[model samples]
Target: MSLVVTATGTEVGKTVVSALLLARYRQASYWKPVASGACEGSDSETVQRLAPEGTRILEEGYSFDPPVSPHLAARWAGESIEVERLVPKGRESGLVIEGIGGVMVPLRDDGVLFLDLLVQWGQPCLLVASSQLGTLNHTLLSLAALRAQRVPVAGVVLNGPPNRDNREAIERFGEVEVIAELPVLDPLNRSTVTQAASGFDTAGQLAGLLDQSQGECR
Candidate 1:
């Protein structure tokens, strides 16, 4: 079973949230299906470094050398990212599947969006959001997009300075849980992830979803 981790937008700490889940969930593995910055660094590399020791990393569906949008990066590589291959088969180990960019990021020129990919996977998602100014709008809009696509969002994780007012506004208007408020760590390392993960309550929220998804296979 896999639990998808998406963001309100790019650089919203989606990978960090996935690392936190991998650290907290003993049975969890990590996978980022499509990577654009393979030359610079891959999210899978960060997860392997931050996840608990000996964690399993599933290879990506596709990788491009440039740090760009999947559509552009794939084009630069003289290929296209097939929408169907992005959804991996269900696995025995629990998985934290990291999504690319935001919900509406185009996976290819033909107009397959990440939100569409989420719908195809039919997996409950954890939205990673920023806590800086203007987050309320982005977070709320993100929730709306997910709802419009009929993707079950498990909750949200605010990954920036702690702002009670904004957090409350999101919860009040969006009607979704904020599972954790991760402070900006000076140095992001395993210790920081472990200490910060105590603030997260997403594993329990996702437990039932993963159990049911895996149970259907059995």
Candidate 2:
């Protein structure tokens, strides 16, 4: 089974949660379709570094240093970000694809949305929403959009500071399962990711979310 990891917006802990999920599985393939604002030393590089063992890094079509939306970033680079160009690794050991920006971000001027690719690939999405204030709206809106488009949503994972009230509201109001709650990490270092990985009850909470026996496909 392939899982698409996306957030309400950029830097909402999508990569961090992705890393943690990867670690929970111990082994999987990762893909970042359209990365933007990646300088010489950037979070994308850090993500690549934090990937668990045996995680094959899939090729990305667009990597921009502008740290902005892919459309504008690609425009600056005299190109365009098109999700159709991304080569699918074909459900090998469960692919985890991370989107470049938020849901509505345009990949090309032709009005192609990033979510379209996730739908085309037919991977159940794992929504990663920040635990900060105003997350309820973001989370709900994202859920509504996905539902409207007939996209398969696996579940939601709340990241960053743990707000018990907000978390409870999301589960009740959004009507989606909360797969995990990742607290804010001090220094926000890679070790925190490792610690989270070690503690995840993968075989329990997340097991049902994962495709256990893609036997012949794998």
Candidate 3:
């Protein structure tokens, strides 16, 4: 009953959405298997700061200093990313996995992609997308790629200013629900994240998809 958080591209609010999911499912543990930009700060650390107190943030599988493509970053660090080792070990339930960059991002020089890893993990994905102008194309393309690989998608989470037209278009064309639309937060702290999470999954649609028991979030 775990979910993978992926996005149309890098910095498109995947980490924020991960925090929101963790807030909604307080018992859920967060794991970012492959992190490329460890030099700045890992998403796991940010989630730990933003998620509810006592939330479990698991250690990453592969961490490289360079903020580049995972393949390139691993190469620069004198290592190679093996997709097999990236899979979660003991945490099979109530885990939220955050992906690096977009769905089609490469994990190695042999052309293995983040999408491939998702397929291997066999968990549904929560696609995070921007609510901006170019999101239609990016979101649709990401969805298409996931569908092409037969990966099950839990739903889409739009991050940024709310746009009705974009949301409608994504649902109509992409044929998936816009589970939640997250507004841009100024301070982006724990209190604000908790407030935002209160509105998310209010109807328990995401909970149903994740097979979580009713009323799990406190």
Q: Tell me, by lDDT, which candidate is best.
A: 3
- Top candidate on TM-score is 3
- Worst ten in a row by lDDT for model 3: 208-217
| RMSD of each predicted structure | 3.6, 3.4, 1.2
Q: Over 4 Å off in model 1, which ranges?
A: 210-218
Give one digit per residue, the lDDT tens place, for model 2 in 1-218. 67788888887988887777676665566778788878745544666667565556776667888878787888899997656678666656667778766777788777888878767877788889998898999999998888888888878888877789888898999888877888887756556777777665443555434554421211
The full ranking of all candidates by TM-score, starting with the best, is: 3, 1, 2
Alpha carbon lDDT at 186, candidate 2? 79
Estimate TM-scores for all models: 0.92, 0.88, 0.96
lDDT of 3 by residue, 1-218 (tens): 77899999999999999999889977678899999888899898899899998888888999998899998998888888988887675545578889999999998998999999999988899999999999999999999999999999989999999999999999999999999999999899999999898899787777754446874568
On a 0 to 100 scale, what is the lDDT of residue 19 in model 3? 92
**Cα miss at 212, model 3 (Å)?**
2.7
The Cα local distance difference test for each model comes to 0.83, 0.75, 0.89
Give the lDDT of residue 110 in candidate 2: 79
Number of the candidate with higher lDDT, 2 or 3: 3
